[model samples]
Target: MDRLFRSRRSTVYSTKGIVSSTQPLANAAGTKILEKGGNAVDACIAVAAALAVTEPASTGIGGDCFALYYSAKEKKVFGLNGTGRSASKMSIDWLKKNHPQHIMPNLRFKSESVFKVTVPGAVAGWCDALGKWGSGKVTLADCLQPSIELSENGFPLSQCSADIWQGEVERLLQMNEKDENLKLFLPSEDWSAPKTGDVIINKPFAETLKKIAKGGKDGFYSGEIARSIVKELNKRGHPMTTQDFSNHTSTFVEPICYSFLDHKLWEIPPNGSGIVALLTLGLIDSLNRNGTIELKSMKHNSVEYLHLIIECLKISFRDSDQAVSDYEYFKKKFEADFHSDAEQLLSSKKYFDSRSSLFHPDHAITNKEMKEGVPNDMFKSDTVYFTATDSEGNACSFINSVYHGFGSCIIVPEHGFALHNRGGNFNLNPKSNNCLEGNKRPYHTIIPGMITTESTTNPAADEEELYATYGIMGGYNQPQAHVQVYLNMILFGMDPQEALDASRISLFAHPEHKKLSDRGEGSDGPSSNDITCVGVEDDLDPDVVEGH
Candidate 1:
């Protein structure tokens, strides 16, 4: 077979079950659950809870989660939106009156700010998914035991996790000296971040996990844990109440899809940014169908191919920013104004054609031109993504995250976890679809992806067999990576391992369009005129880089 990228690792074939994650401990925990006769959903929950303990820098119970589960028995995919909502008191008017500094253009709410904390929904998501799809063999308590043990007995930190933890030391120290995080995370006399291979014990977190294990969702949502989160936020001048925590619930929605290469790519609907992946794939499909760009004919990672993909991604980002938002908000607004819903309008062939027409085959579109083309609108986001498939053929594509590194930089001392800063993604512009509102979810970034064989007779039918469950963790790199990895396997005939190992590109929003102050500004970086800045991995050929 012709191949542009060589695999560094072979794909493991499993007959019983498979669990893949960034940390060995987390993966082991999931595998243990599967070995005990748990289904994919149970294994995924086991992995997620274990990741919260083992990789605290990227994810925890204080964050949010999203998942796509393929139930082999039913032959259908289900989506779970575990994202949290902004505080009931949060609003543009409230921010203008209470914290005007956050409303300034190009100024982002600090990661450590109390206003950035959202109602964490991972625990609720885990409970809901378990109730809906978990194997009867494993109880919630059973699924959480591995993490509880790891947290209480202490687990050696992996090198990559150690690096991420160390990077956040300063940010942690910048919090109040009396803060409990100093005592828990920085156990050293010098208050330093733990080094690689150091055994770290999180007794407090273990206790918190115990609450969830015993009481299930209520264990975390209504008891001491809820009170602690509310007390901390209230003490910090935020208007979070225990009721807000109690009111939190996960939503089960239909997974959206885009047909390409005789298969269907599935993702969680709005609120999560999975729509961006579908939109990006739709544009490329349009280009391929119309003979504008023959993706299969181009050399993998060639300058021409990279440029086309980058340009297509820019368009997708622009459109998603305007279109993607909390499902209820998006549905209401679009239904009233456009007489259409997000899934139908955004995924329609007409929308793809209109967006794809702006793609120039030879040159990049200017930032101004991109802004003009879209009707609307619109993070090294630290996240963990892993996939599991059980012997029963059930598969779960799961993702969990804190919006940024050490989310909100505010640790709940009693709980031993940081509160996620998901509210940081909300727009201050009231007219925007993603504008902050009381008890409203922000436009979430972390998304889990699944793909299945398409029904040739009816491409849009929900009746399809599971092909794979996969995801890549990062901020905006997710959707771009999703499209790239999917195409690598489907269009280029690369194996699963090679599809993942292959070189890829990432696209960032134009600096001028971003509300965040840090856009990596430099003389050689993205300029005001550029539509979107493209970053290529070093593994790609230098000649391809120069040609672009």
Candidate 2:
């Protein structure tokens, strides 16, 4: 019966330990670290860094990141939010000087040329994590060693990449006609498909690796690498400044925890979308005040659950639109009140005042699939999600991105790092959430996950201790992914892999993926994916949950 719900058939093993990500190369590299006796953190660093290099279309040093980690020894969770701020130079007034209306890349959304650029913070994030949590425990240098080498020596290209390059060659080369780095990664030529076991290499990337090996992550953040970035973006008339490079930093916040079933789900705070997932799961729990999740209940709950979640997301995003910004600005507009009480805020009736049964049980469900749908699209283009767990019960769940891939499509020359156009998500109409601002961090696509158990009694008693992180990659579906994964795994009692493999959803208030039935708000696009995409054909209500 589970066969109908399976997502992937491939799983590879590594001696280093264990790492699971969308990209096989990164997964292998992370496993290598574990095999080498590195812990979950060490393995995470190795794979995540390698993904930045080998999977540039998905993520790079210039992107943003969010994470949730569980320390078995401490029995607590730590949240690391790595969204970056705009360069001190990046302001609405400054950008509009050269263009009409001064809207950043309003025209370039289709071109993705040199004009679409923003400050990057992922490199600083990796460095910060390694420096503080890594230190002597796990040599920061060691975790990134493989990535450095891969960048310099270059790894072979997968068939999926070759195909994407073939499709997007013009798009890839539009920014830098003479740029060898872009050309090499997304070669314009098709060298035929891999024959079972083929090895491809990247030499320029190899040189890039060598530079990092000697300079450390800082080499990319503020030194020679930073210089290269500034030079390249400047050459293209981009407005980023050196201050942007130096100003990049990640934040450590307490994970917003929500109770569901017997476990608590945790996710990092804004500029990430993890809050949406936490709230959605909470609403589901609030609804199931008395009953265990049965398949019939699960199916009926899918639509109602989605209605509430989208409503919560609408509310949360409203806050994020206004309050969440780059850390500095958010600090002013959005107070760091760990007591924001996500579950309380979401369950409040004042918000999410919508009817249940947004979908019908009698109707045939749509066959909209999950995943980035691009496969490589998972990390190769816009976003990626990776999770790591060790026998010691130490776990880390991380989601990072360059935002729609290759980030803003502007490469900072010497830095060999591409800038992200995360700012593009903003609205300039003045009447919208997420308007552009100086020193404000763009809202992010990441939502890191964490798993933990609480004692059965009020005071204290024995309870199961489980630690893990699970994430799904998709733009609007991210937090929804977090919620669906938790439902199938915790509420339904499925394994992590199996839970994610089960049927899932792509909940949204917007109409991008959904097929809208009414002539109401967000009535554009194919509404079938949204309208017909809920509930299964012949499954029990609680037996199967969908979307992840």
Candidate maximizing TM-score: 1
How does residue 430 of candidate 1 score in lDDT? 66
1-548, model 1: which lDDT tens digit per residue? 22244556888898998999998899999999999999989999999999999898899999999999998877789999998888888887888898786654543454466787889999999999999999889999999999999999999988878888888889888864655666788878888889989999999999999889999989998999999989988887898889999989899988888888988889887777777788788888888888889877898888888888888877767666565677665444444432135556555777678878888878887655565234432210799999999999999999999867778778896778888888877766665666678888887779899999954455575577888899999888888899999989998888889899999998775555554432211111122234567887768889988898
Task: Note the Cα lDDT for every prediction shown.
Answer: 0.81, 0.57
Q: Which 10 consecutive residues of model 2 have the lowest summed lDDT?
A: 371-380
Where in model 2 is the C-alpha error above 4 Å?
1-17, 101-116, 188-199, 290-296, 299-328, 332-381, 414-417, 429-433, 455-464, 507-548
TM-score of each model, in listed order: 0.92, 0.77
Q: How many residue pairs clash in each candidate?
A: 0, 49
In model 1, which regions exceed 4 Å deviation? 1-7, 107-111, 178-180, 330-340, 372-380, 455-462, 510-531
lDDT of 1: 0.81
